[model samples]
Target chain A: MFVTPGYAQETAPAEGELQTEIVHEEGHGEAGFPPFDTSTYPSQLLWLAITFGLFYLFLQKVVLPRIGNILEVRRDRIAHDLDQAARNKEEADAAVAAYEQELADARAKAHGIAQTAQDAAKADAEAERKSVEADLERKLVEAERRIATVREAAMKDVGTIAEETAGAIVEALIDRKPDDAAVAAAVGQVR
Target chain B: MAEDPIHQFQISRLIPIEIGGLDFSFTNSSLFMVATVVTAGAFLYLTTSSRGLVPSRTQSVSEMSYEFVANMLRDATGPQGMRFFPLVFSLFMFILVANMFGMVPYFFTVTSHLIVTFALAMIVMLTLVGYGLKTHGARFFKLFVPHGVPGVLVPLVASIEVISFLSRPISLSVRLFANMLAGHITLKVFAGFVTTLSGLGAFGVIGAVLPLLLTIAITGLEFLVSFLQAYVFAVLTCMYLNDAVHPEH
Candidate 1:
């Protein structure tokens, strides 16, 4: 059946042609489904081969590679960007750690300076207080020594005055002048 | 308004190109096949021309189809199966586009024929066998001998598996062809009912409404079938090749 019945294609003719079509089908002739027609197989296969082969070639060579490339580029870009982000974050973290360390060191340094200044001031005050105390003690000792010397001088005068007064009283009470040697001897015996 | 639903499938010669006395004339079927390729190719090529890092809507469709087929193959046969991506992608696109083209009014379904679908199925089976054998050598036969059959039933099971293995191409071809052929024919017949019913006077036109609605509904269902059949074909191809990739332990 290289050929289908002529009336089977694109046209439903009058009753006579329809009757002929039915008769051909009754004979199990070429009046059947169009795809089942073996006559068209080679042509269909040929064109199919041509078109499909061309299509396959086009895709394999051009389209698929382009798509794969685009996708790969995007994937690589994303991975690279992510890596950059991670590196930046690490650097930031290190910077923060360094800053905090510097801060801690400066704080300790300030504390040490304050402690040294305080100690220096306390030492200076202690030295000045010690010098003032020594001066006051020296002045007090001088004043005590002067007062002892004055008291000694006054005591000596008092003793001599007492002796003279006693001699005069003796002279006034006696009518005659007394002998110097005997008066002196009596005073010495009483002393 | 011809009652012959078979008229849509007629392959009229558009450009009769006979070669060396064999009737290799370019027909309407060939024209539509070209259309399918151009449509699929143009849509993909133009949409991805910019190769946008961030895809536009149409570009997303292209990428989605790529990932869709890629994921299907990858999932079925792992990364090793990516080698067959070009073939699988082409087959998926061709069948998908052909089926969709058939859905348009009066467009010839290139894949509606047994020879066409059978040829496609043979492409897959041939690849499965050729690559499977070329890579695995004699070990490729291990696909016929599954694991864990008892010693007594190993012979029986191996023969059964061999027959099943052989039937893969036939089944694959027939599934797509029959679905496309039968669905189109059924749609034609139902749509013909509207024509036949409306030809009668007033009341017949009114009765035509039911078949018209049915025809619309079936058309929607056929569109789903078009996409699904393509997916199923690709999935089965991947699975069949998986046998080649990692045979029974």
Candidate 2:
């Protein structure tokens, strides 16, 4: 909606006079409006240019750089965290591998020590049994030799007793010493 | 008709004041600009104060404002345009506030004035040119001289491109100023009609009622227009910025 044209300015007046009147009237046209002067254009333009320059400087120098720094920091932090996690994982894996190897080696050593001890015990048992058998065989041979000796001695004693008895019998008939004839006669009597 | 609109313009004396070599008065326009600034500050402050996750009324409005500009930038340029979100957002908010402030009973629409819009447009143009020059240096001159053109056609194309580039400020400034000025003037005319009609009898009262309803509808539409115009201004700025950032496209 527009304001009505003020009484539709008198258009029938002389052209040159009307123009002058219109110019005069225009000076009071919009009382409430700000004055429009081309003189201020240059100054206004200067201010606008200055404002824009300041804004650009602030953006390029301060604001944008700060934002860029933040992004860069975020990127580096992520990369650092990832790298540290990888390194820690590698260290953990190496430690686990070493522990497993040590565990296997310890078990093998324990098994070897047990086997050596069992071999030593078995060898000692074999040597003790052989010594016991040898002692028994020596005692058996000594006992046989002693028995033979005793038997020989007993036979001799019997022989001696027989001789004495025969001699005594001869003496009872006629006192005689143990000579060849007496011996033969005693032998016949005994027979 | 005055040959210069400046001749038509006069600074009325409301409260006489002096500042340096200038006559500084608390005139209607000055009062309105102050009101615009205050309203803008308060509105933005209140809307953003309670920044809620689920959006308590205020936060929703704030988020919507952000999203609106974000979407516009993306649409005008590309997804990469999100980088200019804050710049575009601020631009939209400033313009929207300025336009809406003028809608109040007695306030000046700074954007309707040519000098203000021209200054804003000049900044965009300067940024575009400066950024292109900084980024591409000597090769940026190639923008005016397209590739694959015969030597004979180069001059014609170069001239055309130069003319087009030179017109950027004019087109940008005119678009915003014209829209605001025209809309306000139209609204004033319709309101004048309603007031005039209301003075008559019953039939005149009925006529006044119709115009009044139309005014109400148009006012709501104007509010939407204000937001849209701000969006348009910001999107264009972002597009220009993008061109400067990557000029080949």
TM-score for each prediction? 0.84, 0.55
Task: Give the per-residue lDDT digits (tens) of candidate 2, residues A3-114.
Answer: 2232133222223443432222343323223325342334334433444344444434543344334445656878999999999999999999999999999999999999
> Which of the numbered candidates is closest to the native, going by highest lDDT?
1
Model 2 residue runs over 4 Å out of place are A1-4, A7-191, B1-31, B49-51, B74-85
Chain B TM-score for each model? 0.97, 0.80
Model 1, span A1-191: residue lDDT tens: 11123234434353344333222223233545566777678888988999999999999899999888888888999999999999999999999999999999999999999999999999999999999999998998999888888887886665555556656777788755666666666666666
List the TM-score for candidate 2's chain B: 0.80
RMSD of 2: 10.5
Model 2 lDDT, residue B81, Cα:
54
Residues B7-59 of candidate 1 have per-residue lDDT tens digits of 67767787777777666877889999999999999998899999998889998
Chain A, candidate 1, TM-score of 0.60
What's model 2's overall lDDT?
A: 0.63
